[model samples]
Target: MSVLDQDLKTPIRLRSLTWLRAPWLFWGGLLILTWAVSHYAFDIYRALDARWIIRFPATWQPDFESRITAFMDWLLHDAQLFGILFRDVTRAISAVIEAPYDLVVDVLVTGLQQGIGQQAVQILPPLSWVAVIFTVTAVGHYTKSWSMAVLMGLCFTYLAVFGQWESAMLTLASVLIAVPIAAGGGLLLGVLAFRVRWVDRAMRPILDLMQTVPVFAYLVPILFMFGFGPVSALVATIIYAMPPMIRVTIVALRGVPEELAELGRMVGCTRRQQMWKVLVPSAKPMLMVGVNQVIMLTLNMVIIASMIGAGGLGYDVLTALRRLDIGGGVEAGLAIVVLAIALDRLSQAYAGRTVTQKAAQSQGGFAMRHRWSLSIIAVILVTGLIGAAASWLQTYPDALVINTGQIWENAIGYINVNYFDTLDAAKTFLLTWFLLPVRQFFVGIPWPWGLMAMTLIGLRVGGWKLSLLVFVLTGLIVLSGLWDKAMMTVYLCGASVVIASAIGIPLGLLAASNPVSNRIVGAFIDTLQTLPSFVYLIPVVMLFRVGDFSAMIAIVAYALAPAVRYAAHGIRSIDPQIIEAGIVSGCTRGQLMRRIKLPMILPELLLGLNQTIMLALSMLVITALVGTRDLGQEVYIALTRANTGQGIVAGLSVAFIAIIADRLLEAAAKRMRKQMGMA
Candidate 1:
């Protein structure tokens, strides 16, 4: 038998240098040589002025942005082929999308922002805390699980009692607009991609770009096109949330049985009929999952959307962040989590509610059969009566609303007082010892040398096409004059990924050792991923006080979820037959893990690395707000100034970094698969 197939009770032992294959020697030598040349050759690595660097002309710097803007204007207007038609097209789309958005905003916003009610002298009243609570309870009961219903009620009640009702309502209203548009648009697009080979191929790159592009980056083009406020936020959220659904839809449609499709064909079904009756019905389970994803992603964008004026809970969090109001900020952040958890569980329940024909026939209770219609009617009646009878029911009274702000304030205050010196010393040490060397290593590398090394790595892994793509993107970042900022961003993300992986892998392995631990770890990961991104900065600011260290800690928290999850999944997914073989051979626990489990799960582990890196990079823009001088910082600066060119260039730089890392890891994963004979 091949050594790879053999199961031995003893652990596999290797002689020194025996495992160092030719590919490793070649790639390792190339990277080292490139690093030497980049760092030591003719002092070309300096940022202020450097050899082997191509700088954009100084002459074009002054009006470059205006020139680009002018060109675009001309292309959209002076270039007459698409002038009036383009305008009409955008106008028609705007009319269709904005009408419902306006109605939702009117019903929820403290005043009508824009709608038929805009000219109405009376301000549109917002939903009262009591009414909203009643509505939430009704929806919870509609889920047909009293436990889930109670959890939903408690979560939203925390929001109302903690004095976040108005903001939560505003956030919920915007999400209402966003989820439907995003979900509907995603479903349509998914169908198109599934049905058309050309569309499926074309959409892959676009989806990659959309998914990897930083959330902070999303605001600029959206702000430029739609202008700031809820409309712009709504549009951006839809774009951000659409990709996953489209992907899920394509997968689900393709998952339908070939035999079933053939049956439809034999029955003389038309294309539309076959899709509507056969394919879509079969795909409903996965489509519902995609819908659940859309809702979660829509909620996830709350804090980000608020950056451009989609107010509510997000606005409250942002406001608190700016003012450094720990208590208030914490409350607002928790409110967002509450909203996310409620939405998530409800959606999950709806998705999981599959009943067999026999099961359906045996089902009891009128509510189970007609939950939606009945729930809506009950909610409307209860809310209407309460809202009409009591002024307080129109809006929760401030006296009745409890302020838990003082609690968090005191907690943070005590920590700051007790641990300030210790934290400062620790932060200083990390800055000096840990973060700086890593930052310098990346930032001080000459552009071409690192680029060449990456190109070589890409060639070794994914072949010529991927290598060329990496070259083009790396070249663009250098030409954009953001190379230094890009390097710092890379450094920050790299350090975070390493640290997160170091912590997460062990946790994952431990969790995988038992089912109870796995469940506990899974719950934690879900909670971590669902929390508002802004909330991560809160405790970091309190402790580390906002720099690379604080940013690193926050990035670690945000990115660790995927890493740990991937590790646990990989460990858990090991073939049981392999385990049985190891056990029958009398392999020790350590031998079984080291020889069988870890080696077998290597491909999955690489995939987890890819996701962890992506998550870390996503935090770049947000981390910059806490004062890290990276590409994210530049994006933040551009956002504040509304500098379209700078913001876009920086955003693209971050995306390029993510894409490069993704390509490298994905290629490595494919290589692992090939080794396992699973390719």
Candidate 2:
């Protein structure tokens, strides 16, 4: 049948318009309309009033502060109980396992300490900062090319000149340690999960939850288990950073050619041997990508972990934020950005080089000769030693150190003189007029109303099963007495998602129209993604102050990437033939884009919206740093107080929200695709 004939037989209907006409819309709209009517039209705002009342136990006086005190007392009692249990368990486990491992750990620690101590004794003085920069440049050149080398040299130069050497080194040390540990754990987990169906089934939801839950929720549990130190920070970073590696590893392993698996079997290879020689080797690229992700996540978390006393560049950033020091935060944030870029590039180079070297080896050329590679390594070593020896005459200084006090004073002074008044004014308006009113509406709804609304929406979109799941998840929040906090979170997330879609979609459309713009915007998105969210929050706090506005801005910045990415993907994926036909049929550029291109990309755009929502939810915990009173805030408070139960509950609430949104959007996307005959 001809295309025009097919169209006549089967008419195209836009889902958005159909959705507007659906009965569910009327039901939802009527409920909202009625609520609006009662509240605004009739001046009956009783249902919109805050219902929560602060109450104190009999042991405390009946006052607001007394209630807070009583709650803290209860919290302390619970913490004490947890501490005792934890200590007893640890001691018991230590008695069982430490006898063997204590000696091993001691021996290793002592040996390493002695070796490092002896090496320190004989070490040459620190090289000139110039020489170090040169060395980095040379290393970069060796890895990639002169442009990268020069860029790396300049980056290191900035660090040294800015006197952030020690802080940067400390941050680097943590990441260097954390990445390997996370990647190793991820590799093992990924392999196990892929090899065992039961493991995969058990782990998939966990991975999803881990990825979805805001990072703040894990902080308290980690702090409790490891205690407050670099070790705790390290553990938290690893946990937060490891999931993507595990996911990618599983995906890559599964994607390996079936013929390769069969070939390994035909060679009589054991399962372990097949995994090691065939499966793993073939999946190296994906595994490397995972490694890259782990590295990025670790670097990103370094600053965040610092807030809980991780101590590093992150500490500096956090301090700067607390003091509302913009320049200092920017300086520290820049260092982090440079570090992220360097590490990212190095990993990419390593991965790309691995592929190239493997191809060279397969070709069996002079370039593949071990002797040449070994000689190059020998020369590098000799050169390093010579430089080390020559540096002995010089006095070594400590790594770069920033005068944070000066930066703080200057930045705070500048903001106080110029920006603080404006920020205060804006904060008053937002709080008094917008945020407070919106928050009141969300928290005012009886728990049942919110539950019914979300459940009914889920049911209509996904089905009865998803509806039940949604009720169970959200219902748990209401029952746990976290309904208000969850609602506040929903409000913030909802606002951020709306703003992100508004900005991201338009940018994506513009970028999709041209190649140069696409590359430019694509690079910006990449930078935004890799740049730690915390770093973005620093400048935001400086500009907007520590309020919902700042938090929303940061959330929108990070969350918008997926929207742009998916929107671009959707527009690009539209068939060229259809676009040409639109043009040939006398449609203007705007008409072609509006009618044909936009509709064609609706499914992909919907998918992007799904991703944008997910990303926004993920930022809930991180955005707490900007001083939100949402579930993220509760999670943060739980961490500081070691309230694991509250933290977990809040985290799960966020996760549930994501899942509900995810399922509904996915179903809608699927339906749209099917309706478009593109399923």
lDDT of 1 by residue, 514-590 (tens): 98998898888888988878899987787777788989999999999877888888987878998999999999999
Report the backbone clash tally of model 1.
0
Relative to the true structure, candidate 2 reaches a TM of 0.78
With candidate 1 superimposed using the best TM-score fit, by how many Å does residue 35's alpha carbon deviate from the native?
Answer: 4.3
lDDT computed for candidate 1 = 0.80
lDDT of 2 by residue, 203-293 (tens): 9989988888878877866665555777667778888999999999999999999999999999999999999999999998789999999
List residue ranges in candidate 2 displaced over 4 A: 1-143, 354-441
TM-score of each: 0.89, 0.78
lDDT of 2 at 546: 77
